[model samples]
Target: MRIIKWVVRLLVLLAVIFVGGAFLLPKETSVARTVTMNAAPEVIFPYIANLRANQSWSPWLDRDPDIQLAFNDVPEGVGAAMSWQSEHPQVGSGNMIIIEAQDPRRLVTALDFGEMGTATAYFNLVAAEGGTAVTWGFTSDNGNNPMFRWMGLMMDGWVGPDYEQGLNNLKKLVEGA
Candidate 1:
């Protein structure tokens, strides 16, 4: 009888710790990865501006070769959007729409993951000595959800490596083009 009572008490304590820890987590999070490519901003910008072009360089595309992709009519600049569905959880269903575009310089997108949430992602370029420095980043708000706040705390570790690989792929494609 005493052992049963202790077990219940321990479970309750763990639950409290988890709930309190989540509340202490940050309300927002962002992850960024940068790469310097041996190409001018003009050369690099076109590849990023078009959603179709991304298929050739995005790491996520390679993850689910059979993923279904639907591109909006605009397809290349502001207003261009793409929706994807994949069986793979890592490449799950979502859509992204280009919200801001500054030719040869920057591009920003509103990314939506249906029930998962929404985020803002951007690609910014700066001219460098022999090429362009490109930064790919995304920011998301956790609101007041303890589960999301916990996710925010681990967002960087979960997404950073993929960002790195995508940038590396972009570098190879542009340089080899």
Candidate 2:
């Protein structure tokens, strides 16, 4: 009985630590990765800023090939939405809207990770030494979710690799374009 009581206490302590860590963790997360493409910003920006052309290069598409994808209120620019549904556990689900954009230059998005709420993501195209320098970044305001705030430590663990891989994939696709 004493051993069981001690085990229960330890488990309770762990849960409390996790919950408290969440609030103490940073409330925002951002991941940035850069890629250079042989194509000009005019050529590359439209592909990403347009969203319609994303599948051709998006790393997420490669992760879940059969994931159901659709577009609504689709236009070539801002206020456009792309929503995806997939059973793949790694991919989960989400919707992204091009909230603001400047053609052939910058694109910003509102990404909602479902239970996690919404966050801001942006893309920038700069004239690089060889081609266009493209940077992909995601910044999320975690709001008051103490649990999510604690997750900030793992934010890079969860998001950075994808950003890097996505940028690499984008580089390959655009350079070939």
Candidate 3:
């Protein structure tokens, strides 16, 4: 009976620690990755602005080759969108829609990650060193969910590598073209 009481106390203490830790975590997360491609922004824009071309450089697509994808009628620019369904947990399911764009300079997208909620992503293109420097970024707010807020703390470590690989792939494709 004494041992059972001590075990219950220990479990209560651990739960308190977890809840307190969640309160200390950030409520938002942002991650950005950049790469310079040896091609003009005009040369690279199609690859990003066009949903079909965009998939060619998506790192996640490589994660689940068998995943199904649905594309909108408009292929590029502000209205372009794509939804993907994947049985892989890491891949999950999501839809992305281009919401704002400035020709070859910038593109902003809205991403809906099913139960994980939504995020905003941006692609900024600028002329640099006779080529284009592209920055890919995503931002999300965890709202009032303590668990999600805690998870936000690890978002950079979780998503940064994928961003780096995607940018690298984009560079290779545009430069090779």
- Tell me the TM-score of each prediction against the true structure: 0.94, 0.88, 0.93
Query: In model 1, which regions exceed 4 Å deviation?
Result: none
lDDT for each residue of candidate 1 in 18-71, tens digit (9 for 90 to 100): 889888888888999999999999989999999999988998988888999999
lDDT of each: 0.92, 0.83, 0.91
Q: Candidate 3 — worst ten consecutive residues by lDDT sum?
A: 19-28
Cα deviation at 125, candidate 3, in Å, is 1.0
lDDT of 3 by residue, 73-101 (tens): 98799999999999988789999999998
TM-score-wise, the better of 1 and 2 is: 1
- Report clash pairs, candidate 2: 22-150
**Poorest stretch of ten by lDDT in candidate 2:** 146-155
Instruction: Give every collision pair in model 3.
Output: none
lDDT of 2 at 24: 76
Candidate 2 CA-lDDT value: 0.83
- Give candidates' CA RMSD values in order: 1.3, 1.9, 1.5
Can you give the lDDT of residue 122 in candidate 3?
95
* Candidate 3 Cα misplacement greater than 4 A, ranges: none
**Top candidate (lDDT):** 1
